[model samples]
Target: MGRGARETVLGTLGKATILQIPPELQDLTRRFGEAVWKRDTEDPQRKLVLLKYLDGNYTNYMQERTRFHKSSFSLEILNTSRQERQLYEFIVSKGPEEKVWQIQLEVYEPVSDPSIQILGWALVNDSCTITLNCTAERGDNVSYSWGSWDTSTSGLCSHNGSLLYLSYPLQNTSIACACTASNPISSRVVTFNSSECSYEQRGKFPRTEHLVLLVVVPIVAVIIITGVFTAAHLAMPIAKQEHLPLAEDSAVHTIYSQVQRVESPDKEPTTVYASVMMPTA
Candidate 1:
């Protein structure tokens, strides 16, 4: 039989090739065969050899270690897009299985790098606030610890979900922040200095001044205007010379009385006629 045809038959039977053929397949079935000869040999759990041909410069152990670290195997097909179930069924229907067995191959792709971010930072009024942020590959959990440069204090304050914020009063002096994030396969450290200080004013000037001026300016203006009006009303005016016009009758009486008091005795009484003169051109 042709190689491809033979492979197809073997694969259908679940044996596949000479490398995976059991010793019992070598024995021929006969009616006269003794019990010992016919005894079924336990198929040593079929060992799938993952052959890796490294370059000339690479060592055997290194290749093995790399394969182990990456968790790669011919049977262990990586579901890159995680569409393994669909791909498995499609490949099974294509051509002969023996042709597929002739190809012994696998590819190793490097894993993604780790991601680190500063999610948030907290500042305590009297103490120090320590924080940490790190994310690993999906399905991987990160282990971490916190420590300061000062030997006086160290411990796991608390771990809330993905955030780590702590206020330590004991080690309030000049200090540094350091932490190690790790998984089963890898680990890394992140640190920062306490000397980096920053400042901000949180209160609002517009709202505060708006409220104060709203209450004070009107009150002061009203008091000033009231005091000015009050002083003007209370002030006493000093007296000065003011003339009054006399009435015609009163003027005549005053003249007669003056004449009666006259001291001329030897003179005869004389009649006097008063004439009013008109003003003319």
Candidate 2:
């Protein structure tokens, strides 16, 4: 940390009421700090127990030690509190100009699982882009990781990380996503289902656009059908037309009979007359 940041942290630590630190903390520091470098210190359980007083993760004892002075040690409580977690610093030095072996300590609680949320989404053409988040109820010293969206893992729908990139035909289908929040002490997982997200949005057009199409398409069809019939009627050829003649001034006209043909050449020709109307004017 920088000097300014360290001083700022120290300034904050100074504001809290000075509660007397437990004397046993120094003894605990001494137990581990003094045994930094030695030979034949093979009592694994004893050393682990001693280390646990500061950090609980030291389950087994391993001799990864170097030259440490058991005589010169100073235990400094960098920051502390009675009811809450605290930070400690154990500094072991041989002399003013010598190397320093410092161990900073802090208490860690089990991480709580973060909640997942669909941050936002966009639909463009045949593809959809969706962003996700798992910051809600964030855990201490947390990390982020996302699960796969495939069938082998029994996951739902496409793509990686906190963003889901899905293809077309998303109707009748869904996407299941998993986001994990983890720390050294614990890990948590949160899942999200995009089925409902893509449920109402079945087709390319939304419900409102579909409604508009429903109204517009039929009107356009009716206009096209009407135009087709009109063009056909206009293109057809009209046959020659004739109307029967009407008598003038309500006068009756002469009637005509069909001509009779002679059976032999000697037979006389038969005369036939057709009714003819003459104009009064």
Candidate 3:
């Protein structure tokens, strides 16, 4: 009827122990009481369920322990009537107490899948093979399987264990490598791109450029060799010519002049000098 009456009846009922309150309903009543009275008593108070139903519906209540602070309580209804279908939730420290009344089951979220890293790479023949290492990020502990790329062509490879395989034909391509992780609640996928691998890069050499360089190198070598041989042959004659002395007699004869003397001799005979005799006794 009212708060005072309800408390009195509860006290009397407790003393007689005549009413057969089911263990579950009794726990609910106790939680309800704590949530109410604690709100009326303290600065910061605890909260509890105020009402519950099997169908999806809920009501909430709040009571302030002090003028400035309050404790709150809520009740949520799951739509399903199935007894087996339970919702899991976390409660502040009093798990055992809350479980008895609320019937709130504990549930876990699905774990995230495992991811891989390329530790090393090797080129076999013309094809490239990658070595992978992996780690799992999970809610609950899980194991992993690694495998080669599947027919579906999803960037991911099937997993047998952490060891997986990927084969790329000797060509240029962006290949996808994937790792899958699963747990009871959920599964996740992680992929490593081929480009991330150190040796995964395919280097290309131009066929035309290679041919051009090959042809040019020998031609240059021949030209250099021919030039060296010609210089060696010419140097011998030049050295011999440098060692020979110049003729001095040939130079004097080149400068001398020859005279025809007939007329010129007559003119020269006309001029004679007189000599004076000195007295001797």
Task: Give the per-residue lDDT of model 1 (tens digit) for 123-222.
Answer: 4564545455645453234556555555654454334234556555533445555655555444565554444323331122223456689789999999
The candidate that achieves the highest TM-score relative to the unseen native structure? 2
Residue 180 Cα positional deviation in candidate 3, in Å, after optimal superposition: 2.0
Mark the 10 consecutive residues where model 2 has the least summed lDDT. 2-11
Candidate 2 TM-score, true structure as reference: 0.33
For every model in order, what is the number of clashing pairs?
0, 1, 9
Kindly report which residue stretches of model 3 are placed more than 4 angstroms away from their true locations once superposed.
1-109, 145-156, 172-174, 197-281
- Residue-wise C-alpha lDDT for candidate 3, range 1-281, written one tens digit per residue: 21222111111111111112134443454444432211111222544333332222222332111111122233222222222123222122233443232233223345565778755555667666766776675544455655436455453466567676665654635566666665554567777765654343433322345657878999999999999999999898889898966554433222333443455754763443444443332
lDDT of each: 0.35, 0.43, 0.44
lDDT: which is higher, 2 or 3?
3
TM-scores, all models, native as reference: 0.28, 0.33, 0.31
| Least accurate 10 contiguous residues by lDDT in model 1 | 84-93
Give the clashing pairs for model 2: 256-273
User: Which pairs clash in model 3?
Assistant: 88-105, 145-159, 145-160, 145-161, 146-159, 146-160, 146-161, 147-158, 147-159
